[model samples]
Target: MNPGASQEPAQPTPGKHARHPKAGSISQPLLFAASTYALGQVANFLFQLRLLYLLGPSQYGETGLAHLLLVTLIFLADLGYSSLFLRESGNSPDWQHTWRYALGHRLAATTVLLAASALGWQLWGSEGASQEYLLWAAPACLLALFNYSSPMIAEGRRLAGLLVTQVAWPAALLFWYLLQDSLAQSMAATAGLSVSLGYLVQALVNVFCSRQLKLWLPLVGKGQIGAAVHLSLIGICGTLHDRLTPFLLAPLAPTFLPFFLILNHVLSGLSGIQAQLARLLLPTANTAPGQARILTVASLLLWGTATVLLAGLLIKDLALFTGQRPWLGLAAIVIFAWGISASSGVLATLLISARLEGRLMRLLVIGMTDSALLQIGAAWAGDAGYLLWARMAGVLAILVWQLKLLKLRFGLAGLTTLALSLLACVADATDWAMTIGTVLLLPILIGLLRQAPCYLPARRAGAHP
Candidate 1:
């Protein structure tokens, strides 16, 4: 018998108690998944607030930098192998065999990431880079390395596990914060260690939950490794764009780094909203072409408007809370630019479901190239202000090119969303403007929220209303 085939279970005899394994047998209901996800988000948001309060801006920035680097390096190192494993796990007759194979890849990638992080820090680290950061960050990175590639098919339970993971960091940090005087440790060090402990907890929970997951499992054949690599290459631009911006900004404008990091976190929350919307709606959109367009435009309208309001309010509140009011204007500018870029992401998801990958790829490449060119030009000129503006211009260029490539024409709702997103740039110009924007947006948002439930089922039933 083949080595990989050996992991396949023997057929059960035909009897009253005979049972067969099914893919996703352990998966939980959608309601449970949604509830867990919301809980995780709330936990994470509170943690960020606590983090800002506990660690002063400087220390918070340092910890954030290290955390981002670890995350980016791990994702880059994984090279889409985890994603490939996820797809294969649902289809393979012997997923345990596939799991072992993916585990081997994951281990290799983790090793590479650790080495790269160490070498990069040694060469380029700031003088303030502390031993405590590394002491904690290393284990945290390793613990999180194999998380997304878990062999568990239990999405709902997995989400609950993740909520535990999310809560763990904040809960640990709060404990450390309270004990700082007794422990004789700096806030930065404790914060780092707390998050590390959180990762450790997550890894432990994952192991316990996934009983089939074991280090000793024998590795199987190289199943679709090439395809994984190909997917990674295709997505490399997005990963770099997402992760490397902070690195670039840090060297040029050290003072702005912390604020930028805060904004990035806020944007991540926004991305989560978009991801959930896409996940919930894309399936229905794929079923009916006419409804897809209607649903797509409506999603963009609701999402875009909500983002503008949320971005403005959150940035304003965060600035006041953190005593970093100077950064509010910059936040608005970033939000305005990214609002357009984000619309493209929403549309891309809907369009991809319609089988337009080739056009999407072409448009993405062009947009990225244009953005890079603008960034380089601005950097070369040594004008930080211009560099920021150039970045926004690049984002606008991307939105334009993407729409052209996808041949998307906006109806009244879509055009209104674009206009509102555009006007969001001025939200930070004055306190009154922000307040007015909020007031005007409240009813639209309320209406959208009320109509949201109807959209999923009604749209799926071929009624746009």
Candidate 2:
């Protein structure tokens, strides 16, 4: 037996509510993940700026299209297996078995999907520039297979895997761009090469980290494959819903795609706080519902504040970069949408951790279907502003459904403060409006903070109490 095995607590038997590592125990990992996410976003933002300067909008749009295609393929290949893996292995004793099972399933699915995509491209392919861009970009699908599995294991372990894998990829790409003096090269070729190489580096780092953590790949069982496929289908649908607007705009309004992509990237960066909090809470969502609830609310408030500040500071730069004033409205919508979605995301994580993914998946399918339909209708109008509003409407619909679920599970009382906070933020878009709203909402925010301790788990005897 490993020397550390005896010193460590024995893994609890998998149950409806599995035991989770304490928050204090994983504090460092959580910090690292958050820091890495923030840093990665900054690096990505700089890289985008550099690309804009070097390639200009038209060339950058081509690169964006290629990247989107690669991302779509990767998402389709994922099939929700990583999340399923994380859930199942949360407290499993056999680390090797679990890691191997998840990795094998992921690899198999990715391989099949990538092969199909390639075959389809060959059978009915585009010509000239579009073809060349896609041809170079296609290799990213293969690298993605390796890039993905490492993070899954890291997340399952609740370690700093994302910090190493996610951050490294972007940093590597930036380095490559600088090294190549990419301004003179074909933008498509440079982007494709940089991305593929970055993922390769990420894959290597992930493998090293997994090994250090003592996770090894093993044989997969037949039963695992069925579950992975089912989960993946739901995941694919969810991704398609999120990507629907861009997908529609790409062909119909190619000019708008680049601006939309940049806006989306910025919004996603703002949403990183929620992502970090979600990761921190995933383990405890089931085991310590009260503490998770408290953290989720706190995270929402913090994210809201950051969004307002960041949006205010970056609004002009954003407009200047995108060369569109309408981007201001889009940015506001994205901020509100992210705020709402973040709250919903917390509840979704709680549900999933509680082994309620089946129910969650069903709700997701319904919500995403509605969202896709709405976005399609909006795209048909051929206005970027209308399309963004439509996307926000879809996000709002999902947010409402998620809130309804939360109310059902935890009651409306705890969420009342959150609702008010969200309302305050919605009204805080402008300086005068924000001043008035903040004055009115100050009491509520203070009261919630004062009562925060009541939301956390009670102290144990002979412990910190």
Candidate 3:
């Protein structure tokens, strides 16, 4: 008998589970996931704060550029295999084969990435701080094997292990920052070491917890490479848009790079919570589109409102954190961008679960291209604020494109949300504008609150009716 085959009772069909492995309500896991994700974000925020203060502007910018390159390479190495694994593992009996194949492919890809990095470094030679940072950071690519793979494994099992694995790296960084203040080692080296340690911890925990699953990696698995490649291509444009933007901007506007990096990080972190929640809600989207739609819309409204409120509350703290004056317009833009991202994420998940990857690929390509062109034009203008607004336009385009693909007709509520966000942008630009915008937002917020309970899990028939 194959070692990967289990003797225990057969698992229920993937989408057939009446209730999520957690409590019946999908909100439970989402809440837990969000909590863990938020904790991780906190740790990450601290780590970035420390690093920025330690390295100062020029060195921090270089580190940020290196970090971006490493992340891009790692994402390329994973090649969307993890997402494919998560989606397929639930239903496929031969999931072990799938895992093995993906693992093999990932290993090969990582090898190629390392080689490419080394080759580029050798050919281009060292340029400056960024190149020096890359030299130290390149070794961390080895950690990507665990970095990319472990989360997927946890996610595939629909376990909280993802939270654990996700938080490990930031925790490691915080630990390092507290214990070691020595400038003896390069900042990049310290960061790489911390991240590598974190990934190792994550890998170990994931493997141990998933032991009962009897996971195995064969030398190669039939058809796995081709399938992963196909899925990966669907994500390429979006990935490039995200990872390449920093690289493009670093050279074009070096002084703004550090601030842009911080702004981007904060915005992405804020948006990440929504993205994670959207991911948690994805299984439901597959099994119950109606419930998922309600939840998605509700989440968008709740978070959108929260974003505006929180930005207002934290404006001072944000300025202090970045050591710069807070730009209300930029803050508003970030909020709107996240709203678009959160909504698009849920919609994208639904489409992906529906096996509409081809459509998604086309949408991504067009949206990313449009966004890139706008960003380039913005960069040429040499204003960081304009660059951010350009990004907002891109996110909005993608959101609109996603709506079209999902065939979700924009309702009055949806139109209101968009209008309010745009108005918030105007408000951010002027003090008087904000006061008027706040008055307009009152009714929208009240209406959303009134509709919130309807999106919650319904009470049992006898219990409620």
Best by TM-score: 3
Where in model 3 is the C-alpha error above 4 Å? 1-26, 90-93, 117-133, 147-157, 178-183, 212-218, 251-256, 289-323, 451-465
Better of 1 and 3 by lDDT: 3
Candidate 2 off by > 4 Å = 1-32, 88-98, 116-133, 147-159, 178-185, 212-223, 229-234, 250-256, 270-273, 289-323, 408-465
For candidate 2, give the lDDT. Answer: 0.56
What TM-score should be assigned to candidate 3?
0.78
Candidate 3 on 1-465: residue-level lDDT in tens? Answer: 232222321111212222342222346655675556666666666766777887898888867766666667877888777666555544457766666666677778888988887687567454555565566556556554553333454355444644654655575675577546765666656665665566566666656655633453434655466556666876667667766567666676677678777877776666556656555555565555434443444445444654474345334334354544355455566566656765666557666656666667778888888899998899789776677778879977887667555544455556666766676666554546535655665676665554432122212345220
Clashes of 1: 0
What TM-score, over all chains together, does every model reach? 0.72, 0.72, 0.78
Candidate 2: 10-residue stretch with minimal lDDT: 8-17
Cα lDDT for residue 349, candidate 2: 67
Q: CA lDDT of each candidate? A: 0.55, 0.56, 0.60
TM-score of 2: 0.72
Give lDDT tens digits, candidate 2, residues 156-263. 644464566465447546756575764554655665566666667766776676554444343666545655665566566656776666767666657656777787
Which ten residues in a row are the worst by lDDT in model 3? 9-18
| Top lDDT prediction, candidate number | 3
Query: What is candidate 3's CA lDDT for residue 218?
Result: 31
